[model samples]
Target: MIDNIRENNAFEADATRDEDTMENKFLTFHLGQEDYGIEIRHVTEIIGVQKITDVPDMPDYIKGVINLRGKVIPVMDVRARFKLPPRAYDDRTCIIVVQYNGTAVGLVVDEVSEVANIARDQIEPPPRTSRGKSSRFFSGMGKMGDEVKILLDVERLLYDEERLSAGLVDQA
Candidate 1:
């Protein structure tokens, strides 16, 4: 990870409070057994469990769309996107409203974890041995005490040019 930079606004403090504040807040979420976090700055809002309007003729990962205060935001099942086994949604299922590439979209996760204030020193660059598959989307792996959090490069994660070409949604 990049050298530990210091910036603490108390905006995204997590359950593990440390003396060294994070430069930014990471909004953590779960996908199967793994834990992931994206910059809280990219997060627009977190809406509770809601009725998802299923749109026909779409990918399985596409859970359909939802009316977010008038705007129709598509919700993607992260578990499906990651090719994990499908499971029923429970109380932990939450929609994370993220604004990327000039549009707002909701990502459905197994559960919303917590906001973590990760320091630069706590983050390590994705190992070259990552096989170059998940490397592009991950900036680094963060060492959050006993639990390690995968730090995602938000822009690359959602706003992929190839994904846009799929005609799913105009990411422009």
Candidate 2:
């Protein structure tokens, strides 16, 4: 009975450690000159920017769709989504594919940085007075050294009610 109790205690300790680790893990990427991060759990894959077929009647940010492994996935330009000026896609441009609401969506970012483990204490809630399309996209800010990574809320960024008003949901 004592051995079983010890094993159970060890299992609980490991589980707690794993949960803590997961909470801090994020996949950091770049959009323009700023760094952003999304929880690692939402990231499905990262692929090079490929040919995106333009779809009409959609928002400018919605660059259109890409054929990814026999699946058509909608791609959004992170810069345009934030109302930033457009820049030509270069070698560093990448598509970070994420699964939100059971649908695969591709986010076009300037480049992918690296996975960062930002402790919970380092994250601050989004500023209440910040107003704009981009402001609603961030869930929090994570501090790493002197840099701040805008942590994106994947659901809010991709599947929010604003997307419905933009006519992306009905067309998709």
Query: What local distance difference test score does each model get?
Result: 0.78, 0.89
Local accuracy of candidate 1 as per-residue lDDT tens digits, 1-172: 1333322334335423532343557999998889999888778899886889999997887889999898998988877766678989899888999988797888888889899888878899977654435456778899888998988886766655466577753332
- Candidate number achieving the greatest lDDT relative to the actual structure: 2
Clashes of 1: 1
Clashing pairs in 1: 1-125
Best by TM-score: 2
How many residue pairs clash in all the candidates, one count each?
A: 1, 0
Please give the TM-score that candidate 2 achieves against the real structure.
0.81
Indicate the TM-score of model 1. 0.74
Poorly placed runs, candidate 2 (over 4 Å): 1-21, 162-172
Off by over 4 Å in 1: 1-22, 129-135, 161-172
Error of 2 at 110 (Å): 0.4
